[model samples]
Target: MEAREKRLIFPFSAIVGQEKAKLALLCVAVNPLIGGVLLKGDKGTGKSTLVRALANVLPEIEVVADCSFNCNPMNPLEMCDSCYERYERGESLPIAKRRMRVVDLPLSVTIDRLVGTIDVERFLREGKKALQPGILAEANRGVLYIDEVNLLDDYIADSLLDAAAMGWNTIEREGISFRHPARFILVGSMNPEEGDLRPQILDRFGLCVEVSAPMNPEERIEIVKRVEEFHEDPISFYKKFESEEKKLTEKIVKAKELLPKVEISDDLLKLLAETVINLGIKTNRAEITTIKTAKAIGALNGRRRVSLEDLEKAMELALPHRLRDKPFQKPPQMKPPKPKDDKEHNHDHKHDHKHEHKKEEKSGSARNQGIGSLEQNFRSIEAKIPRIESKNFDGSEFTGYRSSRDVSITVVNFPKGIPVSYVPSKGEIRDVDFYNSAICAVLNDKKPPIKLEMKDIRVRVRKAKAPTLWVLLLDSSGSMAVKRRISIAKGIAEKLVESGYIKKSKMALIVAKGNQAEIFVSPTKNYWEVLEKIESVPTGGRTPLSSALYNLLLLANRERMKDKSVKVRAFLITDGKASVPLFGKRIKDEIIELAKALRKKGIELNIYDTNGKGINPGISYVPILKDIANAKVCKI
Candidate 1:
């Protein structure tokens, strides 16, 4: 909470390039009627910068002053219990409306935290009245920004899609509750090359824009100049845009007021629908978004008449993710081919064979009636096409027929989803063109194999044995609560256990505190129990780094004797700030001794040191921990 933090970002016009991306976002702002938009691009592409700059121009929100979940009092019907209580008590609840806010959804966030969990303190100490309001509740009627959308752990993304589409936030467990006004514009940004989102989620995005680095030279120069100017004097540069910023704010207000009048004529609507269908998009929602966004663009341009240009702008935003895309996205290319589908493709392929047979079956009288095909006279003509190399094995050269393209037709047919881009309409033609028709007609076709030979071979490589997991040594000292390290520790443990591992590997947890170490959950297949124990551990006590090492030795020794066993590595989850060096021994030597014992037992010790700020400061008692086991740090 710095004083200088609450300030306007650079004006949208001030952004150097990425005009399409900028326009797309602004249209949404003008008419939130357009649902949401995704800014797709790579790192350092100014996606985040452009998004932050949005705060300056987005319309403000009116909220109830004393409402914890910030329910809008003006919409009395939407107020929850707490807000309703104050409303009925006849107390004058102040209303402080503020500019719409952008809430950031960070990765590594736990389900309980992202979606509200019961207030344990109230449930335990006061025996009821659990508190609510997770990130969803707070994001009511605003924007929820998700960075690195592709890499978000799957479960969290599921919840996000649910809340966004349903527009109602509900937590079914612990109690039956409802929060109706939980709708928000979900702005997801990602580098598509990293990975792909589930198709189900991808279809939910109302609009999508692919953002790229500047390709135009003049634009590139402007980018450098604006970025440098902002860097040199961020505050002043922002200040200079204040007037332009205010002007945009006014424009947004005006646009919102003017939005309703914008119309989509039936003719234009049909065009929009045709465009969507031609693009191969799946849902009706895309059409709706395109219409709303087109109108928003018209409103922004100060025109009540929605033009084709406006529709084009909106269509670009709505189709990328929705459309199956060019190059036969429909079945032959659209859906991934299935096993049972091979016959379907073969059925189409057989027409080519049948036409060739018909040509051969012609009566001698028909052949003599001045209607001879060039196929019977191939040797008379000479054509030099690039000779395709043969694909059959040296020993099996006579085994299968090699097609003109050098593809071998084996006894086994290829399965579906494989496209035949070059099939012909006439005469057993595997490929044909108006110009190539005469040429292909002169080529010889191979006679069908009198007796086709076939065989089936299958190899089953057994799945690799599971890697063994060790214990997680967590610091439960009082200071952990102050730094919120305990929460992080528990969260990591949950993730590690949840990190699906094969049956061979096992996980355990050890809580070290006040001169003794206790095993919360033992090494076993029961991961749920381990997770439960981890979440239940209370943080407080002296750090007992020594005892935790001793118990780990016992388990490490037991695991070492097993064949191909992944040595259980203990993740020493600590702040790297331990107290009073264990048992009057030099801390370094103590760490080494523990590590040495582990190594002797064929186990490795790993210390996940969080340097106060979830940043991994490399192995603290390094070379020592290195001796017993490999040590690495992870920050989230």
Candidate 2:
């Protein structure tokens, strides 16, 4: 048993660095109610190693002996059908204790595999309905570790997140219905350079940790030695940390018992909210996670009350991912007015009010300053990661881009939207679908008892409408490079990529510079693909507005040819600096003619003015393009 365990798992205390990440994992172990954690780092940062090692340090849990869902014996109210039925029978259910395991979810996991599916073979053979439990069932009361989580399919990712958040996997397929407990600590590790997580999925994680290679030479040497030792003699390395792992397990056991008694005072709650608000976080999940994590830390230290230090640690783990910090924005200040009471007794009241107001004003101002300082620190850490600023596109573009169409198709079917139809062969079967299929079977049955057969089986046919195509006509000319205009354009393009992910839309990037117009990326629905192309875009070319407009016309024509019903919108990002022309004609005349022709193609153009004062000596030509294209105008 000892040798088997050592072979199966890595020792937690054996990990050399990533103290913060280790602490964050321990905090969640103490209190799974703190939600789950996301680890963002580069490759070879020990993110996955730490998570795998965590299972060894976590104490065993008591679950129903025969339950595949790992149903908690103590929580009868939340048990699965089998366990609940056993409980209802007034039978003493056998309990088994096992070590908490780390269940790995690979990048290629499918939705049906993450969530359970119907047992079609058994149902067809003996008319016995059963659920084939999946990863969620196996992960209950343990850790669900998703490696390379950013690369996971978007639909599968969405489904896993939904189950993780709800703590239950509901399955209704082919007349087999089941709802099993899916409560588990979700640990997702990803290299941010590969891709970015959607905001919705990112927010679902309770804590976000950033890990990197140890900078200190001593620490780096220690990591290398430990890794080498582990690889050379796994059993010896495991034994070396066995005592430490046992102590950690004991600590976690105690922390779990103490977590409920751990109190978060109003002061801590106020601090959590103030910290999140000051950091420009709009969601309340971060605030709740912060307080819960602080309490968990307090519990780990055998304390009854959370401390300011705990709050600080919690902020460090929870704020970085949620912060929408604008480095240029000034820290907010509290403004207080002098009290104006006239009565003799009111003078004392006024003085007290003034004192309280002054105190609050100072505290609020200090918190804001602290928030700014914290953001600066975060910026220093993320300096290597280029951040995309939020879209500042003018009102009309915002409205036009946000207006999503409602049309259904049989293409992409994410785990969202309403279920509309039931086909003979696809999608998960809901309870209603089962009854519908059962009714259809009964109505056609010649025998009495109304037995259903495999031919009677029906599944849901879900449909999702394809989103609009946003064509970005970016000006990568020399004029855009002046005064960081190119940087701003890149930032805007990145924002569009994010928007495309949220809106479920496709984005096409067209860059015109250096005497030519080229397609950086054609219409693509994948955010990672768009981001990769956006990063490779070259800057430093003469503005060629006429050539760019012609390309847009060609693109619009091609998209229409592919699908006439597909909606296409174009955003022209430029400084109105058109110098080159098509066929050696006058530049202005060529642009005007092309712009008129582009408008005729039914492609909506939103022109963003990328000009700063004195950056371009040419007179503003945006008016001409706007007139010819009848486009919406916006100033960057």
Candidate 3:
């Protein structure tokens, strides 16, 4: 059944328009030492299809027969301890040929499942190491594919980084340790619109390619026809590409054989180093990976000498993601204007020259002044706002409507949930942990299934659902700058953020400033970073309240799609004024419609009214906003 499914995969040779992605995969296939490839693009862009199809085109690898670790029989360094012992004893290891596999790392994969777990019972009873192979072990000499890599948990990503860097996985537990070869070509794909990986992990990947749906009409039509044909008759489609696939496989085999012989000139090497330095890439891995990738590319093209073109192509795949600036970064800071002399000002503006220039300079200076003043005001009011005692913010603490009840296996000893899974025991065995003892016993001992024992018992790990995503939309428009209202909004926002942080909730920020609304910060657990970003937002434009709400709706929908059980609570810190109309509709009507839309989506809305009695009177739009949004209104 698995073989048939593998046969039906879309042919790598038949994939359309993702030349860069295909090339990156081929480079890694030719030389796993090139590190790995990260495919970042939108949905339906063939990221997964390309990765799965890559296996069919890869040449067969020789492994020690019956070895769970896929130990390379010829290389003692790549073999497990058991295999190494046999090699040392002058035993001829049985070898088997098999196509390289594409091992998938699921989103819910636990650390134990990723880096092999130990059988405590076997260890204690036999006084020997009994290690179960993990995803990395199974992926040895193969491809490790992680879809939606950007959404991977921090710890899981760290585990991958450590293993990928060392080409080995070490499992240390309770004073016992085991190690195994974990070398593989790591291929990861993600939609950048969802989120981004941390820079440290991103650098671990040797190459990065951004893919998207083909824009050319002809190419798109061709892609559609090819996919439809495959769906109609997968076997026939596989046969059609069999020759091309074989040729590609043969080419990869040749490249791997020739990779060691391929050489780069010293001048070309110097050029590579100089190029990396110019790109401002700090990691030494960039230079090393680029050099290896260049050699692979040369070998793939049946060349022994690395050419300038190979170096250029290698750099093209290697440098883009390594740059300092990443996607969705905050816009650059506004520089203060240079003072203009009266004569120059008069020359530039003939009519009302002095008055116009003075007004222009004052406006720019005032805008800067307003931002400075807002920060200063926030500092003064910050202390007055009560500070809660800092506690470890766990997501499970939040409970309300739309909050997820899905079990989170990430947390241990979750006080109020039923056990859903059994993890490796951490020295403690409870009465309720007998659920998987038999299975553990069978896996630990080579003999027939035995009775459950305390040593074989696993730990019961359970937790509440995923955290609520809080989206804070701050009004940084010109009107809010009046009476230092924007400052008050910032203070309220900071307080809300702090409150959520204490609950271990994820927070996102959207600022309604200038002519548009921007996502200042994506949903993140780093509340302090969000607060810092909020402090720097300048105030000076029409209130794009509708725009802000529209963006909030989009963000909420995206988050919901990523995790269906995610509860989104949006806080609109504004004076309830909508000066900028989205879709050219009435400002009041647009705001009300968007609010209703948000409410219909089951997203909880809250209005933090910054209105006050002063020279600039409040518009009092909060009452209507509250009614339409079904929101809770808080006066600040």
Per-residue lDDT of candidate 2, residues 524-596 (tens digit): 6555666657667888868878788888888878887887656677888888887777769888778778877
Arranged by lDDT, best first:
3, 2, 1
Error of 2 at 586 (Å): 10
User: Model 2: which ten-residue window has the lowest total lDDT?
Assistant: 327-336
Q: Estimate each model's TM-score.
A: 0.51, 0.69, 0.64
Question: What TM-score would candidate 1 get against the native?
Answer: 0.51
Q: Give candidate 1 misplaced runs (Cα > 4 Å).
A: 1-3, 6-11, 76-78, 81-94, 120-127, 172-180, 325-636
Q: Which ten residues in a row have the lowest lDDT in candidate 3?
A: 388-397
Each model's lDDT: 0.60, 0.72, 0.75
State which candidate has the highest TM-score: 2
Point out the higher-scoring one by TM-score: 1 or 3: 3
The sequence of per-residue lDDT tens digits that candidate 1 reaches over residues 102-216 is: 7888876645556676664344344453555688877776777888776665557777788777766666534535454566777778875454455566666677778889888
The whole-model C-alpha lDDT of candidate 3 against the native structure comes to 0.75
**Deviation of model 3 at 19, angstroms:** 1.2
